[model samples]
Target: MDYHLYPLGDQGVLIELGEDINLKVHERVKSVSAHLEKMNWDWVIEYVPAFASVAIHYDPMKVMEKEGDSSLYAYEIVCAYVEKELEKITPSHSEAPRTVEIPVCYGGEFGPDLAYVAESNDISEEKVIDLHVGGDYLVYMIGFAPGFPYIGGMPEEIATPRRKEPRLQISAGSVGIAGKQTGVYPIETPGGWQLIGQTPKALFRPENEIPSLLQAGDKINFKPITREEFDAYKEEEK
Candidate 1:
C-alpha cells in the first residue's frame, strides 16, 4: 500500500511501489498493475510494470475532457485520480503466479562461452549446467528486447560476469549468465551476457494475443536437453 507517484514526462505517471527488488516489492508492483488494468479508465493509454515500479501512460486530452475543467492541468488531474484509486490496492488478492519451463541445450556450438563461465567460476562445465538447472528462477521483468526475461535466483556457485566484448549477433534462444542473474535472449540481438546454452522455445510470438511468452512474476524452471531433443522441439514448432 505504500507508494510514491511522479510524473513520467508529459503524459505518464511513474508509480514507485518500493525501493528494492524483492519478492515483496514484486508482489506490490503486480498488484498495482492488475488493479490499474481492471480500472479500465478511458484516459489511461497503457501501463508498463517493472521490478519495483509501474509506468502508466495516459492521454492528456482525454484526461482534460473527463475532468471537464480546463483550468486544472491534465497531469494534476491524472495524478489525483491515480492517487485515489491506488489507495484501494494492496499486495494481497492477486491471482496465483504462472510457472514456465524453459528447455536449454548447453555447451558445444550452441554455447560458445560455456568454457569461459566454467573457468570464471572455478567449476567444471557440467557442474555449471547442473547448478543452472537446479536453480529456482523467477522472471522479475521484461526489457531490453521484446519477450526477453530478466530472471533472478540463479545459484551463486555458477555466477559469471558478462563478456568483455559483446557479440555483434546472438541467436535467438541463447541462454546466458550476467553477474548473479541468468536469462534467455528472446530475439536475435547483441548482448554481453555469458553464454551457457540455447533454448528451442520461442519467447516472442507476435501473432499471439499476448506477444511475450513470459511475463513478470512468473516462476521459471530450466530443463537441460540433448542436441537431438532440441532439434525435435524446434521441428515441432514449425
Candidate 2:
C-alpha cells in the first residue's frame, strides 16, 4: 500500500498509488476506489479514479465539524484520515475486472482515416484492422466527453499519431487511435484521433443509472463486424 497524498486545492486529496500506468498500479487504484465506496464517510463528496491515482473530494465544513479541531486545517484533517484508510487496503482484495466486448465495423464510410492509418503503419488496411482486433485493451479512464473511454493496450504495430487537423464533428461510437492508445468517441464532438472504425453500440446512455458504457479497470475486446452486421445491430437498437 505504498502511496503519496497531495492536496487538490483545499477540498480534495489526490492519492498517488503508483507512478506508472501498468496493471499493478491500476489494481491499486481500483482497490482504493472499491474500499472508498464501502466506507460511509460523511465528509467525502466524491472520488475519481484515474490511471495511477484516486482523487477524493471532501466537504471542508463537514471535515472541520468532524475533527472539532480549530488548530488543524480541513485539508490536514482529511489527508490524515485518507492515509489511515489507504493503509488498510491491499491489491489482492480488489474485485475481478470485467471484460466488455466492443464490436467494430472498420474502413469505408465509418472510418475515413483507415487508409491513412494503414499507410502510416506500412501495413494493409485489413492488417491494421486485424492488429487492432487481436490486441487486448483496457479502459484506463472515461474522459474528454461523456461516456468516452480512453482505452490502452493497443498493439504497437498498429500505433499511429493523431491527425494534425481535428474533425469538427465525430459521430458517436466512432473508434479511433491516437499514439499508443485507442478510444471510442461516446458523443458527437471535435477530436484529433485517427478514425479507424465505428461501433453500432451506444456508449453513452444518460437516462441509465450508469451513464458511461465503460469504466476504469474494465477489460475490452474488439470484435470486427461487417457492414451488414453493423447496420443490423443499429436496427435492433431502434
Candidate 3:
C-alpha cells in the first residue's frame, strides 16, 4: 500500500514499492502493473516490473494531449494519472502465480562448478543435488538475458558463492546458484554463478506468442534427470 512515484526522465515513471524484495512488494508491483495494463492508454508503451519497482515507459506527447494541457510536463502528467490509479489498488488483489517444472541434468561437465559447490558447502554431491531440487522457487523478475529469470526461495543449505573469475561463455540452459538465489541461463552468456545443472527446455522463444516462458510472479520446480535423458531431450529438439 505504501509506495513512492518518481520521474524517470521525460517519458517514464518509476514506482518504488519498498526497499526489500519480498512477496509483499512483488504483489503490489503486480497489482499496479495489472491496473495499468487494463487502461490500454495511448501514452503507455511498456511496463517493466522488477523486484520492488515498476518502470513505465510512455509517450510524452500522447500523455500531454491526454491531460488536455500542452504546457504540462510529461512526467507530472503521467505521475498524476498513475497515482490516481494506484490509490484504488490493494496489493493482495493480485492473481495467483502459475507454476512450471524445469528438468535439469546436474553435475558432470555440464556443470563444472558442481564439485566446488559441494566442497564449499561441506556436503556430498548427492546431498547438494537433493537440497537444490528440494526447493520450490519463485520467479521475482526476468532480466539480464532475454527470458533469464531472477528467482528466489532457494534454501540456504545448498547456497554457493559466485565464481571468483566468471566464465566467458556459460552454455545455454545452465542452472546455477548465487549466494541465496538460483536461476537459469536462457542464452549462452558470461556469468559467475556456481553452475549446478543444465535444463533442455528453451526459456525464450521469440516466435511464440508469449516470448518468455517465465514471467514475474511464477513458481519453478527443478526436477533432476540423467545425462542420457538430457542428451535424448536435446536430440528430440533437432
Candidate 4:
C-alpha cells in the first residue's frame, strides 16, 4: 500500500493508507487515529477514518495565511506525521475488542432470505443462524451511512453476493452484505447488499446524543431469538 498524502486546500489532508479493506487496513485506521490524537496538531481539527484512509481536517484560512498557496506543503506536514507513526509500529494488541450482544430473529418473515442462503451453501437454514451467531464480528469502520457498521467475521460458507437489483427502500436495522462485508443499515434507504435478517435494536437513536450504538474497534455478537421476543422488545420500547 503506497501512502500518498493528498492536500485539500490549506486545512485538509487525505492519507492513502491502503488499497484494500481487511484486518490490516483496519489496523492502519487505528494507527493513524492513535497518532493524530497524540500529535494534537494545532492545524488539525478532526481525523475521519475510513476503510483505507484518514481525512484530516484543519482551519483552511489559518493554514493558507501561514503556509502560502501550496497544497503540497500541507501534504508534507501530514505525510511526515503519518509516516513517522507507521515506521514505529510497535504492536499494541488491543484487547479482544469490547463485544456487544445483539438479539436477532431468524428465518420466516424476519429472515426472508434464510432459505436462499442455506440452499446456496448446501446447509440447513438453522445451520445458517448457528454459523452467524457463533462468532464475534469485528467492527472495522462506519461509512456508507450513519450508524451503519462494517463488520468482519461472516462465515465464508454463508457469504452470498448482493442482489443484482437492490430494493428501492430497505427498512432500518436490515442486516445485509455486499461481497465479503456484512453491515446493518440504520435507516430505510436504497442499497444493493444481500438482505439476510433484521435486528430490533436501534442502531441509531438521535436523542441518545452519540446516536451510533456501535463504534469502530468494537466486537459484535448475534443472539438468535424468537419472533415473539422481537415483538415483545419492540412493544416494550413503544
Evaluate residue 52 in candidate 3 and report its C-alpha lDDT on the 0 to 100 scale: 92
Residue-level lDDT of model 3, residues 83-197, one tens digit each, is 8898998877436679998989999988888899899999989998998888878898999899999999888988888999999998989999999989999999998999988
Clashing pairs in 1: none
Model 4 alpha-carbon miss at residue 99, Å: 0.8
User: What lDDT does each candidate get?
Assistant: 0.91, 0.90, 0.88, 0.78
Top candidate by lDDT: 1
Predicted candidate 4 versus true structure: per-residue lDDT over 112-136, tens digit per residue: 6778778877999888788888755
Model 2: residues with Cα > 4 Å off, grouped in runs: none
Selected candidate, larger lDDT, 1 vs 3? 1
- Model 3 regions more than 4 Å off: 68-71
**Residue range 168-199, candidate 2, lDDT tens digits:** 99999999999999999888999999999999
- What lDDT score goes with residue 172 in model 2? 92
Instruction: Report the C-alpha displacement of residue 168, candidate 3, in angstroms.
Output: 0.7
**Model 3 TM-score, all chains together:** 0.96
Positional deviation of residue 133's Cα in model 1 after best superposition, in angstroms: 0.5
* Residue 232's lDDT in candidate 1: 100
